[model samples]
Target: MDWDDLRIFLAVARAESLSGAGRGLKLDAATVGRRIARLEETLGAKLFVKSPQGYALSEAGDRLLPHAERAEQAFAGAEEELSGIAGQLSGQLRIGAPDGCANYLLPQVCARISDANPGLEIQVVALPRVFNLSKREADMAIAVSRPTAGRLTVQKLTDYHLSLAAHRDYLSKSPSIGTKADLRAHRMIGYIPDMIFDKELDYFAETEAEVVGLASNSASVQMHMIQAGAGIGIVHDFAIPFAPGVVRVLADEVRLERSFWLIRHADDRRSERLTRFAEALGQGLRDEVVRLEREAAQSGLAPP
Candidate 1:
C-alpha cells in the first residue's frame, strides 16, 4: 500500500472514527471513508469494525499498526535530516511534560534550549502524562512515569524532598507540631482527588493528616493556601518551596520520589537534529537536577 494511505490508516485507527480523522486532516468525511474503504479493498481484509459508538481496529489493522508507526518515524527522521543540512536548528520541536515539571523543573533547561538552538522553537504542551511518542503526538517528552517499553530511554532527572510545613506566623500562634501524630489536629490543605502527582501519597492515610481542605488541580494553588495558614500541607521542594512564608514544620524521614524520562521514537534516534536536541536537553536536565537539589538543601529540605 502507498505510504500516504498508511498515514490515513494510522489516523483513522487512532481517532477511531472516519469523521474524527477527517476533522484532523481537514478532509471531508466521505473522502476519508472512501480512502479507507479503498485501502481495505486493495488489501482484501477489514481494517476497522464500526459500531454506533465509533471505529475500532480489527485484528488485521492491529497487525499493520506498528509497522505503519515505524514507517512514519522514518519519514519524520528523513524530513528532519534534510532540514538539518540547511545548517541551523529551526522549526517547531513539540515537547510534552506534566504541568508540574513545566512549572517547577523545566524552565532552566527550556531556557537553555532556546539559547543554544536559537531558531529551534519549542511547542511546550503541558500534558498530565507522557504523550504517545510512537503516534507522533510529541517529538519528545519529559515524563514522570518510568519507561515501560523496552525500546525507550529513561533517566533520573532528580529527586524532590518534601517537608511538613506551615507559615511561621501560624506556627507562632499555634504550638510547634512534633511527631506524625500531631498532623491529625491540624487542618491540611490537600490536592483534588484527580491530581496527577509525581508519586502516590496513599501513605498519608497512615499519617495524622486531617485533610480538611481541598483545592483545584494546581499544586501551586495548594501551596499558597497552606502558606496562608489555611492548614498544614505537604508541598514538593521542586513545585512549591520557592514561595515566601512557607516554612518547614518538621523534617521527614519519608519522601516521595519521581524521575523524568526523555523518550523519543527509537526509529529516529539516528537523525541529526533529533539526536542533538535530545542530547542537549538531557544535558540541561542533568545540570538542572543538581541546581534544584542545591536550592532545596539550602532551604533545609530533605532529599528523596
Candidate 2:
C-alpha cells in the first residue's frame, strides 16, 4: 500500500533478484529481501516465487505491475513538477544505444547537453543488443530499426550512411578493389556473423564477400581493426572523423543507409521533462551526425 514499498517491489520485479535489485537501489540484498517480505505481508499475497533462475513474478505480482508502473510515473511527474525549472533538465536520464552510435556520436552530444543542464546526470549504455525499455534498462533507447510492438513511442532520430573502409596503407598495399568481387581477395573485418544483433548491422548480407577474417560484435572494435590496417570493413560515415588513418574503399559501390530511431515508453509522453529532453537529444544527434559526416567528407574518407 505504501508507495515506497511499491517502488522496491518494482525494482525487484524488474531485476528479478535481490542482489540485482539491491545494487540498483543501493541497498543490501538482505535489506531488499526484508522489504519485499514486509510488502508481501502487508498485501497478504505472495508477489514472487524464488527459484534458481531468480525471482519470477507470481500471479499477484503480475497483477500488481501495471498499478506499480502507474505509481512510478506519477512519482516521476510529481518530482518533475516540484523541481520547478521546467526548461532545465535535472536528474538521471539513461540512454541505451548500439555501440556504433554510442561510441561515435553520444560522447560529444551528451557533453553538450550536460554543459547546458549542469544538474542532469546522463548515462549511456552501449551494447550490441536491443534494450528493453519496458524493463527500465534505459530511460530511453536509440535503435537502428523501428520497433513494431510494445507500449512505446518511436521517432526517427537520423539517417546515417556507411561504406567500406580501410586504412590508406592497407589500400595502397592491397590489390585494386574496383568491384564487390574484388573484396574476396582481401582480408575482411566485420561483425561476427552469428553475433550481429540487428539485420541493419549485417552490412555484407548482400555482398559476395567470402568471410570475416576478423570479427567483433562491437562496431568500435571493428573500426579500430580497420584503422590498424587489419582489413577493410563497413564503417559509419559519422564515425570516420574519429579515425584519421582510415579511408573509404569502394565507397560508390558499397554504400549503405540506415536510420536511428529514438524509442521511449509511451507513458513518457505525459512527462514534460522527458519530452523536452527527447527533443534536445534528437536535435543534438541530427546536428552531430551532419557535422561529423561533413568532416569525414572533407577529409576524403566519406562521400560528400
Candidate 3:
C-alpha cells in the first residue's frame, strides 16, 4: 500500500469530510476522494461508509487508525533525527493553553522560538477545556493545575495574580464597596458556573457574593463586559494594563493567586527541540510577570 494513500486516508478520517480533508492536505476535493477510493481498492477493503453526514470509518478504517498513527510517529522521528544531525529543529510543535494566557502570553514566546529555529512551526490551541496530553492533543501544555498521574513531566511555569476590578465609569456610578459585604449589592461579572473548566478557575470563593450578575466562559469576554461597565469582575493582574479604564478594586483586601504548570509527555522529554522550546516558554512567562510587577508599581496598582 502507498504511504501517501495512508496519509490521505488519515487526513480524511480525522476531518470526516472530503472538502475538509482536502483543505488540510492542500488537495482538491476530487483528488482526495479519488485517493481514498484507490486506497480502499489497494487494500481490498471498504474503509469508509459515505453518508450525508460525511464519511464514517468502516471496520477496516478503525483497525488502520492506530497503525497509521504509528507510521506517522516513525516518520516524524526519522525527520527529527535527520534535522538533529544537521543542527536544526524542523516540523510542527503544538502547544495547548488556556485562552486568556494564550492571548496574553503565547505569541511573543512562539515568535522567539520560531526566530531561533527557522525551520520549526508552532501551533497554538487556546481552549477553555484542558488539553489531553495522553492522546497527543498537544506537544506541550500550559495548565492551571498540574496533572496528578500520567506519563508526563511537569514543572512550575509561574505564579500570576488576580484581583477584583471594574471600569472607572462602572465604579463611579455603581454602589460603593467598602468591604466584602458591600459587594453584594453591586453587579458582578464572572465565569459561567457550570462551564468552569477546572476547580482552580472558580475564583468567586474569594468574594463574599456566591453568584455573578453576568457570566461568560471566556476571560476576555468577562474583561470586555467589565470594561463596558457591565459589572465588576475578577481579572488577571497582568491584563489590567492592556485594558485601559479597567482598574483593580480591593487589591489589598482581595488578592487571588494562581500558578501555571508546564506539562509534556514523558516521551517528548528527551527531544532537544521540545526542551529548548519549553525553556523559552518559561523564560517568556517569567519576563512577563516581572513586567507586570513593574507596571503595577508604576501605575500605583500594586497590591498591598
Candidate 4:
C-alpha cells in the first residue's frame, strides 16, 4: 500500500532477485524482502512466486503491475518537471544491448552523455540475451530486431557490418579459406547454437558452416577467442580494427549485415531523461557506424 513498498516490488519484479533489486534500491536484501512481505500482507495476496531461478510475478502481481507502472510514471513526470526547472537530468538510465555493441560501442556513447549530464547515472548491461522490456530489464535496449508485440516503442538505430575474421597467424597455419566451402574444414568460433537468445544472432544459419566447435554465449569471449588464434569467426567491422593481428577473412565472399533497433517500454517513454538519452544514444550510434564504415572503406574491406 505504501509507495516505498511498491517501489521495492517494482525493483524486485524487474531484477528477479533479492540482491539485484537491493543493489538498485541501495537497500540490503533483508530489507527488500521484508518490505515485499509487508506489501503482500497489506494486500492479502501473493505478488511473487519465488523459485530457484528468481522471482516471477504471481497472478495478483500481474494484475497490480499496470497500476503500479502508472504510479511510477506519475512520480517520474513530476521529478522530470522539477529537474527541467533546474536545467539538468538526474537518476539512473539503464541501457542493455548485445555484448558486441555493449563492449565495443556503448562505453564511448555513455561517456559523452555522462559528461553532458553529470547528475545522470548510466547503467549498461552487456547481455547476450534479448532484453525484456515487459520485465523492465533495461530502460532502453539496442537490439538486432524490433519487437513485434508489447507495450513498447521501437526505432531503427542503424545498420552495421559483420564479417568472417581471424588472426593472421591462424590463417597462415590453418587450412586455406579462399571460399565459403573451406570454412567447413576450419574450427569456427561462435555463439552456442542452443544458447542463442535471438534468431538474428544465429550467424551460422546464414552460412553452410557446420555447428561451431568452439562456442560461447558471450560475444566478448568469442571475439577474444578469435583474436587468440583459436579459429575463424564473425566479428563486427567496427571492432576488428582495434584488435591487433586480427584481419577479416574472405571479406567479399563472406559478409554479414545487421541493423540495431532501439527499444523502450511505453510507460517510461514520457520521461524526459529516457527521451533525451534515447535521442543522444541513437545519434551517437549512427555517427559511430558512419566512422567505422569510412574506415572500412579506406581499408578496401567490406562495404561498411
Candidate 5:
C-alpha cells in the first residue's frame, strides 16, 4: 500500500471532508476524492461513508485507526533517524504538561529548541488535563504523578514547592495574613477537581471556607488570576518569580512540594524529537529548581 494514500485517508478522515483536506494539501477536491478512493481500493475496505453532512469513518476505518497512527509515527521516527545522519533532526514534537510548570519554563524551552533545531517544529499542547504517555496521547508528558505501569521511560524530573500568593494590592487592602486563620478570611482562587496535584505531600488542603471564590483547572491561569488580584491562589515557588503582581503573604510559614516526571513510552526511544525535547525539559527544570532554591534562601523563607 502507498503510505501517502493512508496519509491522505487520515487527513480526510480527520477533516471530515474531501474539500477541507484538499485545501490543507493544496490539492483540488477532485484530486482529494480520487486519492481517498485509491486508498480504499488498496486497503480493500471502505474507509469512509459519504453523507450529505460530511465523511464519517466506517467500521473498517475505525478498526484501522490505531494501526494507521502507529505506522505514521514509526515512519516519522525512521525518516528523522536517517535525516539526522546528515546533521538534521526534523519532525514535530508534541508535549503536554501541567499549567503550573509550563508557566515559567515553556517559553524558554521552546526558544532554545527552535534555535538549536531549525528543521524541527515544536507543538506545545497546553491542556487543562495531563496527557497520558501510556495511552500515547502525546510524544512526551511532564506529569505530576509518576508512571506506575506501562512500558514507560520515566525520570524524576524535579520537585517544586507551592505557596499561597496574592497581588501586593490584595495584601495591602486586606488584613495581613499572620496566621492560617487570617488566610481563611480572604477570598481565594483554587483548582477545580482531581487535577494532578500532590495530596500526600499536603500541597493542598480544605481551606477554612471549604469552598473557593474562583476556580480553574489550569494552575497557570489560576496563578495569573491571583496576580491579576482575583485572589490568593496556591502557586509553585518557580511560578512566583514570573508572576508580576503577586507576593507571598505568610511565606515564612507555608509550603507544598510535588515531584514532576518526564515520561514517554519506552518504545519512543526511537523518536529523535521526543527524546531531545524531554532532555531539554529535564535540564531546564533542574536549573530552575536551583534558581528557586537560591531565591527562597535569600528570602529567609523555608522552602515549600
Candidate 6:
C-alpha cells in the first residue's frame, strides 16, 4: 500500500538478498529486513522464500511484481517531469553494453551527451552478457544481437564491420598468411567458444582456425591480446583507432558485419526524459561509429 515499502520490495526482489538491497537503498541489512517484515505483515502475505541462494519471490510476490513496477515507473516519470526541462536531461542514466562498445565507442558518445546536459550522470556497465531489463539492471542496454523475448523495445543502432587483425610486428615475424588456409599455421586470438553469449558474436565460425590459442570473453581483452602480438583475431573496425599497433589482416578476404541494438524496457516509453535521452544516445552512437571507422580506414588499418 505504501510506495516506500513497494520501493524496498522492488529493490529486494531485484537484488535477491537483504544486504544486496540495503547496499542499493543505502540502508543497513537489519533495517531492510525489518522493513520487509513490516511490509509482509501489512500485506498479510509472504513475499519471499529464503534459501541459501537468497530470497526468491513467492506466488504473492510474483503477483505483486507488475503492480510494483508500474508504480515505480509512474513515480520516476513524475520526478523526471518535475525536475527536468524540455531539452536537457538530469539525474542518473545507466547503460549496459558489451565490453567492445563500452571500451571503444561509449566513452566519446556518452561524454558528448553529458557535456550537453551537465546535470545528467551517466554510468556505463560493461559486461559480456545480456542485461536483465526486468530487474532494472540498467536503464537501457546496447546489445550485439536483437533479443527475441522480453517486455522490451529494440531499435537497430548501427551495422559495424569486423576484420581479421594482428600486430604489424607479429605478421612480419609469423608465417606468411596469404589465405584463410594459412591461418591454420598460426595461433589465433578470439572469444572462448563456450562463452560466446550471442550467436552474432561467433566471429570465428567462418574461419579455418581450429582453436583459439588465446581467448577472452571481453572484446577489449582480445584486442589487447592482438595488440600485444599474441595472435590474429577479429576486431571491430570502429575500435581500430584505439589500438594503433594493431593492423588489419586479410582485410579484403575476411570481413564480418554485425549490428548493435538499443534495448529498453517497453514501459519506459511513457518517460519523456528517457525518450529524449534515447534519441540523443542513438544519434551519438551513429556519428561516433562513423567517425571512428573513417579514422581507422584513413590510418590504413581498415577497409575504406
TM-scores vs. true structure, each candidate: 0.80, 0.96, 0.79, 0.86, 0.75, 0.96
lDDT, residue 79, candidate 3 = 74
Query: Which of 4 and 5 is the better model by TM-score?
Result: 4
lDDT of each: 0.70, 0.91, 0.83, 0.84, 0.73, 0.91
Residue 61 in model 3: lDDT: 92
Please list the Cα RMSD from the true structure of every candidate, rounded to 1 decimal place. Answer: 3.8, 1.8, 3.7, 3.2, 4.5, 1.8
Task: Give lDDT tens digits, candidate 5, residues 190-291.
Answer: 876566454432344734445578887777788778878877777777777676656676665666667888888777777766666777768877887778
Candidate 5: clashing residue pairs, number: 0
TM-score of 1: 0.80
Sorting all predicted structures by TM-score, with the top scorer first, yields 2, 6, 4, 1, 3, 5
Candidate 3 versus the native: TM-score? 0.79
Which segments of candidate 1 are over 4 A away from where they belong? 28-30, 85-88, 129-131, 147-153, 193-206, 210-212, 215-217, 252-255, 265-272, 299-304
Per-residue C-alpha lDDT of model 1 across residues 1-304, encoded as one tens digit per residue: 9898998998888788888888878998899999999999999999999999899999999998889888877787777767663466767788888766677767778787888667788878886555777556777777766767755656555554555667666666764476777667777766565664545433355356756465546556767787777876766665444666666655664355556667776766766777788777777777776776566556653121
Best of the two (4, 5) by lDDT: 4
Model 3: residues with Cα > 4 Å off, grouped in runs: 48-59, 81-92, 131-140, 146-156, 262-271, 301-304
Distance from true location, Cα of 33 in model 3, Å: 3.4
TM-score of 6: 0.96
The residue-by-residue lDDT of candidate 6 on 132-169, one tens digit each, is: 99888999999999999999999999988898988888
Those runs of model 5 whose alpha carbons end farther than 4 Å from true positions after fitting are 10-34, 48-70, 85-88, 132-138, 146-155, 192-209, 265-267, 296-304
Cα lDDT of candidate 6 equals 0.91
Model 6 residue 62 CA deviation in Å: 1.6
Two-way TM-score contest, 5 vs 6, winner: 6
